[model samples]
Target: MRKSVLLFVTFVLFGLLSSAQQTKISEFDLYGCWVLENKKRPSTNIVTYKLCENVAHEDVKFGSKISLLAFNESEHESTGPLACFTTFTEKGTWEFDENSRIASLYSGHEWLKEFKQLDPDEYASWGSPEKFDKLKFRVISIENNQLTVEIIPKQYGKKRTEDSLE
Candidate 1:
């Protein structure tokens, strides 16, 4: 009876550990328009992954009080204040690795240039992509239509900042 009880306890502990190790996010859950919810400034920051079907490239639309930038194959017109804002549009791609839990955004130089203009200090510090061409983030969680990602600092080889989106 003592041996049986010990085995049962071990099994329960193993089950709990395994369940805790399971990931909360999946690749399929990442297909949508994720807007930056915790922006340092009041701006429109959006990242779309497979959001629009039949489109060649993924979409990333970021707009500030001064400028608006888009990375997409199709033309996306923004009316009102966004239209009047200085605009830059292009094509981009994105990918996700479930094993590493990394989401990579391959928006080009224009996006980076505009991003630098939007926040020069941030761009100088950690916002600049180590690879120059791709920005990688580890998907921390996806709950209640919100996605939280932590920037994977490639150059500094450390974790930098978190970006929450909904």
Candidate 2:
């Protein structure tokens, strides 16, 4: 009876350890449309990120949406025509690093030129490539159909290098 009890305890301990291990996130796990949750104004101006096989340009009622395609291409669309001076459809590329859990997005448009042409005052205020071209985010977790990411701050006086998703 003691031997059987010892065996049962060992089995239980092994099971517990196995359950404690975190599962690694794969590209397949990120293959879906995820909407950004706005805690302050949940119903207003919703931003969405769609990481899928194809890019779909859907109209948003309030905010903006970005579609990350399978071939590293991206499309961005925003509402509030007067407020947003940028083009209705902006093309870009995205990269994800599984090891570091870092995702980077590189916009294909010359935002500085566009902003200067559209709104000179706004362009003079904020028209840097650092502000408009590249964005990096560290993925915290994806749970219960929600993706949580933390913005990675840009490093000053250093050139940013891109990492390939593997």
Candidate 3:
């Protein structure tokens, strides 16, 4: 009976550890930078994407949502001298769930002041009409160093990044 109990406990512990590993995504795996591949708005099939947009997620030391997103205007057909290499960056923090492979960026929190960096207007089509909300992205697939994520629309009471970020 003792041996049987011990074996059952070991199995339970191992299962818990395995589930924990699958639950949370490590910051190290996302230490570098990731760009936006696709962004579907709140209520429309009109997907907003970037050709060469990049999101530089540095160590959390700098700040939250400090990741930079450089959007190529040519993809939107609004190309111009100042629009070609413009970039829109997040101004808050980043939280990721490994089990769900969802990355939520709390942007639109603060205003940006970089002259070279494009304003959030470039990403006007990304999020919902509400001014206060977080950007939720679920990883579709990761292959060949390319991470494709789908922008999840925010529902009622989903404003800002919450603990129930599903």
Candidate 4:
């Protein structure tokens, strides 16, 4: 009976150690400067956004200060610098599911919403309710002093039509 108890205890300790040794995501994996490459606008107005900066991913606390640059089209010509940037200070809880490789965005204290990971290197920006559904950004080749990022528009709504019965 003594030998059997000793063996059981050893097995439990080994199991706990193995579970604790699992890999965890590091801060550097999300730290970088990202840029925009493409976009789609609404009918009423053409709106585009760009982003840049470092993101922090702690145990349960996630935060990032990013710059947003926007562009607008006017008349029949493209306008210059319709751009204004503001830092998004996000303080929330985060969880990463290794099996599905998804990351969840959560704000425990506020009226914010949840965001899911669309791709390995792409993050779904759950913008204002009036904004588009998703913005797909992929990190392209980094050369010289430039980091190229490709932004593909994936959510453009349908248009309305006028029906005439004569």
Q: Report the Cα lDDT for candidate 3.
A: 0.46
Give me the candidate number with maximum TM-score. Answer: 2
Off by over 4 Å in 2: 1-21, 41-64, 78-87, 109-133, 160-166
Model 4: ten consecutive residues of lowest lDDT:
69-78
lDDT for residue 15 in candidate 3, whole number 0-100: 94
* Tens-digit lDDT string for candidate 4 (41-119): 3443222222342222221111122222122110111113453432244333333334433323333222322323223
* Candidate 4, position 131, lDDT: 24
Candidate 1 global lDDT = 0.52
TM-score, candidate number 2: 0.51
Q: Candidate 1 on 49-112: residue-level lDDT in tens?
A: 2223323232333431111123322222233455564555334556677887886655455667
lDDT by residue for model 2 over 20-89, one digit each (tens)?
Answer: 6655676566654444332343443222343322333342233335555777766666444586645566
Model 2 lowest lDDT segment of ten: 44-53
Model 4 scores a TM of 0.24
lDDT of 3 by residue, 55-103 (tens): 3333211211223223200111112357654444434556677777776
The C-alpha TM-scores of every prediction are: 0.48, 0.51, 0.37, 0.24
For model 2, which pairs clash? none
Order of quality (TM-score): 2, 1, 3, 4
Superposition error at 129 for model 2 (Å): 9.8
